[model samples]
Target: MITKSDSTTIKSYLEDSSNLHGGHADKVLIPENTAELSSILIECTSKKMPVTISGGGTTTTGSRIPFGGIVVSTEKLNRIISIDKRALSCVVEAGATVDDLQSACGKEGLFYTSHPTEKNAFLGGTIATNASGARSYRYGPTRKAVKRLKMVLATGEIFELRRGEKLFTGRGVSFGLPGGRRIEVALPSYDMPNVKNAAGYFVKDDMDLIDLFIGQEGTLSVITEAELGLELKPPEIRSCFAFFKDEENSWAFAEDLKGKKEWKILSVEYFSENALKLLRRKNPNVPPASRGAIFFEEEGEEGQRYSAADRWLKFIKTRGGSVDDTWVAMNEKDAENFTSFRYAIPEAVNEIVKASGFRKFSTDIAVPGGNFLEMMRFYKDLFRDDGIRNVVFGHIGENHVHANALPVQGAELRRAESICLEFVKKGVSLGGTVSAEHGIGKIKHMYLKEMYGDKGISEMVMVKKALDPGAILGLDNIFPKELLQ
Candidate 1:
C-alpha cells in the first residue's frame, strides 16, 4: 500500500464525479488484497485515524472525499476470481471495474444486471450505493442482483455474508468481526420507499442482513469482494429512439408503453427539448424534428424483436411522430451508437456545468409510479414560467427523471440548489425518494435528514454506531459530520 503524501496523487484521489465538492487527505493507500486491506484498517483504527474507502472515483456524491485521514483505494484489488457460467454467477474483487465485469460476461454470453458500463465505476462502488441505470426498470438495481459480499470493517473485522445465511431475532443479526469483537446492528424502525431508492440506510421487517451492506455507502464496512448473479443473454435486443414534437406527449407515450405485455421492454428513457439541445451540442447529427425523444429497448427472440419494433413504430406515429423520424438499431454497432446517444445528454450537461465554472446541482429525486404525473406537472408548471435553463431526462419507466439545472451565474447556482431541495421535498411528500440512483453521500446528507426527520435519522445513527463503533469509516458521508464524533 502506498502511503506517501504526494499532493498530486492525493488531490486526484479526493475528487469524485461530484466535481462540486472535494476534501483534504494527508495520505492514500491502495490495498492489493483483503489481507492488506484488513491490516491497513487495523493500523488506522489503532491510531484513531479517519479512513475513507474509495472504490471507483465515479461517485456523483462526495462519499469518497476524505475529510482528514488517509484514503484507502481498492484500485489494486481488482481481480475476477471466478465466473460460474453454469450457475450464472461471478465472484470479483472489490476493485474490478464495471466495464471489466461486463466485458467478461460478454465473453461468456452471460450478463450482469447493472448496465452502468462506466469504465471508472467499480463493482464495489455500484454495490456501495446500490446504483441502477436505465435497464433497472426491467432488472432492478445492484442490490437485487447481489448474491454475496465480503467486507473489512473499521476494526479490521473481515467477514463474508450471503443473503440467506442469517435471520433476525427481533433484535438484529450479529457478526463476529475480524478483531475478535462482536458487532450487532439491530434493524432500523423506518421502512424504505416502495419505489426505487438509494438513501442513507436500508431497513425493513425481516430484511436480509445483506440488504444493509449492499447500499450502506461504506458507512457500515469497506466492501472487499462480491458475488454477482448473472443471467443468460437475450437472443435479440432491439432499440428505438422515438422523438416527439411536444414534450408532454412523450411522457404520455412512455406511460402507455408500460402496459405493453407482448414485448419485453427493458428500459424507457426520456430526453427533453433542452436535453436534446445539449445532445446536439455534443453530437451534431442527433435527428430532425426532434424536440423531445423517447429511448426504449426490447429484448426477446428473433421473431419477437421485429414485432416489438413494428409495434413501437405504429405507436410513435399515432403519438404524432413520423415513422421516418424513429431510429431503429438491429445491428450491434447501431445499438452501441444508440446507447451512446442516450449517454451524451449527461456528458453535454457536465460540459455546460464545467464551462460555467460552478458546481453542478443536478436533482436525482424520484416519486412513486402513481405520483409520477403529479410530480411532472409540478416540475413543468414551476419551470415553465421560470428563467432557469434546466433539462429533464433519465429513467422515465421508474418515474425518476433527473432535472439538470444549468445555472451560469453564481446567484443562479445558489438558486439551483434551493430548487433541487424543493423538488426533493415535493418528491418525499408524494411518498417518493429523495435519491433515486445516487445515494445520500456527503452532499445530500441534509436531504436525507429532511426526508426522514429526527427520529428516522436517529435510527440510522443507531445502525451506524453498531457497525462502526469508532465512526472511523466514511466521515462526512450519509450521516452528519457531528454524528461521527
Candidate 2:
C-alpha cells in the first residue's frame, strides 16, 4: 500500500459533487489489491481510526468526503477480473470506473443498464449507493444488477456474498465469517417506500444478505469487488427530444408514455421551462417557443425505426407538443448529441452551485406514479411562492425528478435549504422517498429522519453497529457519527 500524509495531496479527496465543504483528512492510503485493503482496515479498526472509502469523487452526496479520518483510496485496485459471457456477468475490482465497465460490456455485445449519468463514477460506489439513471425507467437500479460481492468488513473479515445464498429469517440475518466466526444482526424494521429510493438501509422482510450491504452507504463494510449482471445490447435505440409549447403538455406527453405498455419506452426524462432556459445557454437549437421538453428512447428492429418515429410524432402533436421542432436521433452521432443534452443540465447546475459557494440543494424525491402530478404541482407552487432560482428535470417515468434550487447569495441559500425540507416533508407525506437515487451522505440526515422517525433511525443504527463495531467506516454518511455512540 502507498500512503500519502501530505495535506496538500490529500485535499482533493475532501469533497464530492455535492459541493459540501470543510472535509479534512490526515492522510490517504492507496491499496493495490483487496488483500491490501483488508489489511489497512484491520489496522485501522484496531487503532479505532475512522476510515472513509474513496471512489471516483463523482457522488452528488458527500459519501466519500472524509470529515476527519484516514482516507482509503481504491484508485490502484482498478482491475477487470473477468467477463463470463455465458453467465452474462462480469467481475471487477472496486476502483474500476463505470465507463470502463460499459466499454468492456459493449465489446461483448452486453450492456450495464444501471450506469449512472456520470461516466467517471466507480462501479463500487455505484453499487454502494444502488445508483440508477435514465434507462432505469425500464432496467431498474444497480441493486438489480448486483449478483455477487466480495467485501471486507470493519473487523478485517472478508466474505463473498452471492444473490440468494443467504436470506433474512424475518427481520434478522446471519453470516458465517472466516475462522469460525459468525455475525448475526437484526435487519431494521422499516417499510421502504415503493418508489425508487436510496435513503437509508434497504430493509424488507426476508431480504437477501447481500442486499444489506448494497445501499448501506459504506457504513457497513467496504466493497472490494463486485460481480454485476449484464443485459444483451439492443440492435439499435431510437431516442428523441420532444419539445412542448407548454410545461403541462410535456407532463401529459410523459404520462401518456408511462401508461402505454406497448410503447416499450426505455427512458422517459423531462425538462421544465426553467430547465430549457439552462439548456438554451449551451445549445441554441432548443426550440425558442418550447415551455418544456421530454427526452425519450425506445428499442425496435432497424426496419421499423422510421415507423416508430412517425407514431411518436403523431402522438406528440395530439398532446400539443411541437412536431416540427422535435429532435430525433436516428444515427449514432445524433444519439450521442441527445445524450449529451440530457447530461448538460446537471453539469450546468453544478456550475451554478460552485459559483454561489453553497452546497447543492436538490431534491431526489420520488412518489408513486398515481401521485406524480400532485407532487409536481407542489414543487411548482412551492418554488414559485418562494421566488427562488430553480430547475426541474429527471426520470419522469419513475415518477422521480430532481428539483434544484440555485441560491446565488447567503440569504437565498438559507431559504433554499428551508424549501428543500418542505419538499422532503411533502414527499414523505405523499408516500415517497426523501432520496430516490442519491444516498444520504453527510448531508440530508434530517430529511432521512423525516421519512423514518427516531425509532426507525435507532433500528438502522443497530444494523450499523452490528456490522461496524468499531464505527470506523464511513462516519457521518447515512447518519451522524454521534448516533453510533
Candidate 3:
C-alpha cells in the first residue's frame, strides 16, 4: 500500500470533470491488491472515516471527488486477470482502463461493445455507473456487458457475484457471504424508464442481485473486478457525416436510420447548429448552410462495403441531405478522426464552462421514442427563448440528447441551472430518465429526486445503508449525504 498525506500530492484527486469545488481530503491511499484494499476499508470503517473510491477521474458527475475523506484510488490495482477467447469474455481489475481493455481484446478479434467514448475511463468506474456510449445503439449499456462483479463492502467484506445466480424475492434480496455474514436489501419500487438510463440504483421486479451494485455509484460497495462479455469485431465499419440544412431534416434522417434494421447501424449521433459552431473552430470543413448534422456508423463484410456506401448516398439524398456537404470515412484512420469530431463537442463545451468560471450544467435526459420529437421541440423552444448560449448533441438512436448550457456571467449561470432543472422535470414527465449514461453523482441529486419521489429516494438509501452500514463510501453520490442519517 502507498499513502500520500501531503495536500499538494492529494490535490489532483479532489476534482473530476464536473469541476465541482470545495473538495478536500486528508490523505490518498493506493492499495495494490484486494487484501490491501479490504484492510484499508476495515481501518476506515473502524475510525468512522469516509472513503471515496477513485477511478479514471473522467466522470463529469463529480462522483470521485472527496469532500472529507481518505481517497482510495484503484490505480495501482490495475490488472487484466484473464481473457477467454472462446467464451468471448474477459476479467479485469478495477483500475484497468477502457483503452487497455480494448487494445487487449482487439488482439483477439473481440470488442468491448459497451465502452464509453472516453478511452481513459476505468472499466470499474464504467461498470459502477452502468455507462453507455456511441456503440450502445447496437450493443446495450455496461449493465448488459457485465457478466460478473467482485465487490468489497464498507465493512471490508469481499464477495463475488455472477448474473442470474441470485434473484430478488418480491422486491427483496439476500446475499450470504464469507464468515457467516449475510446482507439483505429491499429494492426501490419505482419503475425505471423504458428508455436509456443510468440515473440512480437499477431496480426492477425480481431483478438480479448483482444489478443492485452495478449502478449504485459506489454508494453500496467498491467494485474491485469485473467479468465482461465481448463481441466479435466487425470486418468493416462505414462512418458518415450527413449535413442537413435544418434540425428537422437531421431529426428525420436519424429516425429513418433507426427504423432500418437491415442497415446494421452501430450508432446514430446528432449535433445542433450551435454544436457545429464549436466544431468549426477545430475543423473549418463544416458547411455554412448546415444547421444540423447526423453522424452514423454501420458494419458489414468487406465485399459489401461498396454497395453499402452507394445505398447510404441514396438515403442521404432522399433525406434532404447534401452529398457535396457530407463527409465519409472509408478507412480506420479517417474513422477515428470522425470519432474525435464527435467527442470534440463535449470537450469544447467544457472549455467554455471552465473559462466562464461556473460549474458545468448539462442534461443527460432520455425520453421514450414516441415522445422524442416533443422533447426535442421543447429543448429548442426553451433554448431559443432563454438567451443563454448552449449546444445540443448525443446518442439520438436512444433518444438521449445532451443539452449543455454555457453561461459566461453569474446571472446567466443561475438561469442555466434553472433551465437544466426544467429539462429534468420535463424528461421525467415524458416517461424518460433524468440521466441516461452519466450516473447521478454529487451534482444531480436533486434531479434524481425529481425522477424518483421522496419515497423512492428513501428506499434507495435503505439499500445503501444495508450494504454500507458506516455510510463511508461515496458519501455524496446519487443523493445527499444527510439522507443516510
Candidate 4:
C-alpha cells in the first residue's frame, strides 16, 4: 500500500546519507514492521525487481543502495523490545542505533562492548558488517556479541535463528505459498573463518548458525531483530595518548607494552605522520610534534597502579623515543574529547576530498605483528613513489591499518586502485588480510579472489545461490558478479 508520494519521499530520504557513490534506486519502501517488510519483499520478488535494505546509510561500500528497483528501509522499525538482564542480553529492532542501545544498557549498569566508529550506525548494519573497533582486540567483534536473529528470507518467509542451531533448513529456506502450499530449497552456508571476518558469507561446519546472518550484509536475508549479549562495565577506566618520533620506536614500544603482564591494554591505535598532521590541524590547541600517537586504555585498583598516561611517558623515556606530548583521560569528559579527536580523521578526510573534487578510497589491511612494520615501510615508499598522497592509521593492537588514498578522479583513481590491488596481493602473500575490519563491499570486490582462492570463493558463490537464487539482494556486493555470470 505504498503510494507514489510515499515512494518519492523514501527515495529522497535514502539519498541523504554520507554515501559518496551515486548509485540510486528506482523505487523505495519504508516498512513499519516485519509483516510490512515481508509484504514489500513479496511484491518485489514477484516483479523481479532488485531490492536493497538500508539502516543508517553510513555504509561506504555502496551496499545500502542498488543501481535500480526498490530500496527497503528499516529506519522506523527502530526499538529496543526487551532486555533480559538475567541472561545479559538485549532484543532490539534492526534500525536501533548503537548509541541508543548503549544509553539503554547504561541505565542498568551494563554495556554492549562492540564499538563501531559511527554512533548513528544501526544495530542491524553493525551485524551486517560484523563491525568492530579499537575495543575488538579485547571484546571481539559483533559476531561474538550477537546471540540470535529474526531474519526474512528471499522468498518472503520469516525465520528465527539462534546461536547453536542449523541454518540450511527449516523456515529459513522454505516459504508457505497461497492455499497452504509449501516451497523448499536448500540454504547455502559458507565456511566462515574463525577470525575477525566482515567480508562475505561466513561459513563453517561447526560454526554457530547464528553467525551466518551476523555479517551477510543483508544479501541472504534481512535481519529484522536481534538479541545481543552484554556485559557489566569495567569498574575503572583510563586512557593514555603517547607520541612517538618514528614507526620503529612505536612498534618497539607496543611490543614492550604487550610484554608487560601488569597492564591490560584495551586498544593500541597507531597514526602516521599524515594522520598526526590532520589531527593537529583539526585541533589547533594540541601540539604538532607527534609523528604518531597510541591510545592505551587500562583498568585497575585506583592509586595502586600507574596511570596509563604516566606509563606511556615512562616507556617512551626509557626507550629514548622522542615524546612530543601526552594526554590522559581519567574522567568521562576527557575521554569523550580524546575519542572525538581520534574519530575526526574520517570526517576530515571526506570533507577535504569533496572540497578538492576528487574521489577518496580507504585500503584496510591486516598483517601479522611481526610483518606490520615491514609492510608499512613498503607501502609508505610505494605510495610516495607513485605520487599518491594519503593518510595511514588504524588499530595497531589488532595489526590492522587503514591506508586512506587522497582525492583521485577518473584515470588517476583507476591507477590508484591498481596500486592498491597490488598492495593487497602482496599483503596476502605476506600472511595478511586484504580487508581488516571493513567488509568487502563493492570497492574491494575485485580483490576478493586474491584473498580467498578459487575453492574458497566457489564455496561462497554456491552459498549465495542457494540462499538467494534470484540474486536480488545487494548484487555484486562482496564478490564480482562477472564470475557468477
Candidate 5:
C-alpha cells in the first residue's frame, strides 16, 4: 500500500513539522488508511527502523520527530466516522482536530469539554498526552471523555477497545476464538487518581481496558479512532475579570472562590508581570494597569449573577484586590474577546522566542493546595535571584502553574537549564510533579524519576516492555536509555 512515490511526498511534508530540539527526521511514511498503515508499520518493524508519530506539532516535550529513522504522521487520517447522539458519544479518526470536533458537536447543541490550548491538535496526540486544560479543574481531562478506542499495536495488529469490556487477544476480530480459546488478554492495572493526570499510562486493578491506552504516548499503540462522551453547553454564561495588586492577594481570592458553593468557576488563572506584557502585546486595548487576571464563568438563573458578582467584589475589596477592568459577556463576541486574552499567551511566547532568536523552555509543576503559596513565593524568589525573566501562569485553581523560561541562547542557555533542574528538585521536595500536562517525551525524561521514585519508574519501564517488546514506537523517547543506565 505504501508505494515509493507515497514515501517521497509524505516524507517531505512530514519534515515540515519537525521543528523540535535535536532535529527533524530524514524519512517519513504516511498511510491513508488502516490497511496501508499496517503494511508500512510492518515493513518498518521488520527493517528495525525507529518510528515516531506526530499530530499538530504542538508537543512541548519534543515527541514528534524521530531521533534516527522515520516519522509516521496521522494528519491525513482526519475523518469523523459517526455521531451516536443517543449514546452521547462520537466516533472520529485520530487526526481530526479539536476545532473540527468542537464545530461538529456545536451543530447538535452538544459540547466536547476537553479544551486543549492548541485547537489544531489532533485527537491522537491529545489521547497520547491525555491532554487537559483550564476546565480540567471541573470536567477532568481527555481520559474522562473517551469511551472507546481503535488502536494499532506495535506488532501491527489493530484492536478496538470498548469501555467495561476486555481486550481481545485471540485472532479474527472476535471476542472469543474457536478451539476453546479465551480471546481476551488482561493488562496489569493501577488505580488512576481521580484528579487530572496527563503524565503517563493510567493503570489500576479492575480498571477499564481503555485506560491503558489513554496516556501511553504511542509507546503501546497508535490510536486510529476514538469514541468520546459529550455534554450539554451551559445555558447562560458571564465572564468576570478580577485584578490583584500582588500574587498574595490574588491567591487569597482564589482560595475564597474555591469555597463558594453557588458559582461554577470554570477557570481561575494567574499571570506574572512578564506574562502581562505578552498579554498587552496580543490585545493592546486591555488596560495597562492590570497586573494579574482571573476569568470566571457563571451558569444557571439570573438571580445568582448579582450574588456571585457581589461576593467577588466584596472579597477583592477586602483583600485589597483592584479591578483594572472587567467585561461581562451576554453574547458570543464579548466572550471571544475575554477568552482571547487567556489563549494569547502561547502564541505570544512563540512570537517572542522567534524574534529573540532563542529556544523556548517551560516547566509545569503542581503542588498541594496548602503549599501552593509557599511554592509560588519560592519560584518568584528563585527567578528574581537568578535574574531570569520568564512568564508564569496556568490553572491556578488546581495549583498547577506553567513557568516559561524566556528565550535564551549560548552559555546562558546552559545556566538556565541548570536553574530549571534546581527548580525541578525543589518542586519534587515540595511534593509536586515536575511535568504536569506535558508528557515526559525526551526533554523531561531525565526528571521523571525526580517526580516519581525509582520504583515507580521501573514499573513504567516494565509496562513498556510488556506492551512493546521491540521498543519500536517512540523508542528511547519517553523513558530513554540514559535513564536506565
Candidate 6:
C-alpha cells in the first residue's frame, strides 16, 4: 500500500464536488489491487480506525471525503478484465472510470446505458450509490446493469456475489469469513420508496442478496470488482432539443411525451429557465423565445427513428414550438455538443458557488408522476418567496427533478438549507424519495429517518450491526452520528 501522511497530501483528499463541507484525515492510502487494499483495511479495523472509500472524487454527497482516520482512493485498480461480446457483458475493476468502460464497450459494439454527466466517475462509485442518469429513464439504474461483484470486508475477508445466486429466505444471509469465522446478516424490514430512490439500504421481504450491497453507500463492504451487463449499441440515436415557453409548459409537454407508449424515448431531461440562463452564458446556441428546454433522445430502426422524429416535431409545434427554432443532432459531432449543453448547467452552478464562497444547497427530491407538477410548482414558489436564486433540472420523465439553490450570503445559505428540508419533507409526504440518485452521505444522513420511520430504521440499524460489527466502513455516512452511540 502506498500511503501519504503529509499535511499537503492529506488536504488534497479532503473535498469533493459537493463543496458543502471539507474533511480532515491523518493519512491517505492508494492501494493497487484488492489484496493490498484488504491488508490495509485489516490493520485499520484492528485499530478501530475509520476508512473512507474515494472513487473518482466526483461525489456531491461527501462520500469520498474522509472525516478522519484514513482515505483510500481506488484510482489505480482501473482495469477492464474482459468484454465478452457473446454474453453482452463486461468485467471491470471498480475503479475504472465511466468513460473508460463505455468507450471500451463501444469498441465491441455494445452500450452502457447509465451514462451520467460526469463520465470520469468511477464505476464503483456509481454502484455504491446505485447511480441513475438521464438514460436511466429507459435503462434503469446501476443496480439493473450490475451482474456480479467482488467485495472485501473490513476484516480482510473477500467474498464474491453474483446476481440471482443468493436469495433472502426471510430469515437472513450467511457467509464464511476468511479466518474461519462466519457472518450472517439479517435483512432490514423497511419498505423502500417505489420511485428512483438511492436513500438507504435496499430491502424487501425476499430480496436478492446482491441487491443488499449495490446501494448501501459503502457501509456494508468495499466493492473491488464488478461484472456489468451491457446492451447492443442502438442502430440509430435521434436527438432533439425542444424549447418551451416556461418551466410549467415544458414539464406539461414532458408528461404528454412520456405518455405516448410507442415513442421509444431513451431519455427525457429537463432544464429550467434558470438552468438555461446558466448554459447560455457559455454557449449562445440556445433557441430564442425559450424559458425552458427539454433535451430528448430516441433509439429505433431507421423507419422508426424517422417516425419518432416526425411525431416529436409535430408535438412540439402543437405545444407552441417552432420547427426552425429546434436543434437537431443527426450526426456524431452535433450529438456531443448537445450533451455538453446539458452538462454545462451543473458546471456553471459549481463555478458560481465556488466564486461566491458559499456551500451548495441542492435538493435531490423525486416524487411520483401524480405529484410531479405540484412538486415543481411547490419548489418554484418556495425559492421565489424566499428570494433565493435557484435552478431546476434533471430526470423529469421519472418525476425526479433536482432543485439546486445558489446562495451568496450566509443568511441566504441558511434559508436555502431550510427550504431544502421543507421540500424534502413535502416530497416524502407525496410518495416521493428524499434522494432520487444521490445517496445519503454525512451531509444528508439525518433525512434517513424521515425516509424510513422508527421501526424501519431500527431494522436497518440491526442489519448494519450484523454486517459491520465495528462500523469502521464509511463511518458516520448514511446514518447520523448519534446512531453510532
Candidate models: Cα lDDT each: 0.83, 0.90, 0.90, 0.73, 0.70, 0.83
Specify the poorest-scoring 10-residue window by lDDT in model 1.
Answer: 170-179
* Backbone clashes in model 4: 3
lDDT of 1 at 109: 93
What is the clash count of model 6? 0
Give the per-residue lDDT of model 1 (tens digit) for 1-53. 66658898678787777775558888898877788898988888788788888
lDDT of 3 by residue, 425-445 (tens): 999999999999999999999
Per-residue accuracy of model 4 over 1-485 as CA lDDT, tens digit each: 34333555666544422244566667667788888888777777777777888888776666675667777777887999998778899999989999999999989878898988788899999999888988887788888898888987776787787777654443244434333545444333333333455666665544556766677876778998999999887766677777777656666676677677677667777778888888888787555555666777776555533445556677767655544566677677777788888888777776766665654467777877777777878778878788876888877777777787774555677766777887888777777777666677766776667877776677677666766666777676777665555
lDDT string for model 5 (1-485, tens) is 23323545644433212134455465666679987787767777777667788787777776665667677778788998877777888989999999999999888878888888788889888888888887777778898899988877666777777887864232112243222333333343333333345655565655566777887777777898999998876765566767666667667777777767666777777777677778777668555766666666655554455565666677667767554455456465676777777888877776666566655567777776777888888778878887866888788888888877764656567666776777778777777777667777767766776766566666677666655556678775567744333
User: What lDDT is obtained when candidate 5 is compared to the true structure?
Assistant: 0.70
lDDT of 4: 0.73
Query: Model 6 over residues 6-89: C-alpha lDDT tens digits?
Result: 998777688878785658888889999888998988888889888888888777787777777888888888999999999989
For model 1, the superposed segments whose C-alpha errors exceed 4 Å read 178-180, 303-306
RMSD of each: 1.6, 0.9, 0.9, 3.5, 4.1, 1.6
TM-score each candidate. Answer: 0.97, 0.99, 0.99, 0.90, 0.88, 0.96
Between candidates 1 and 4, the one scoring higher on TM-score is: 1
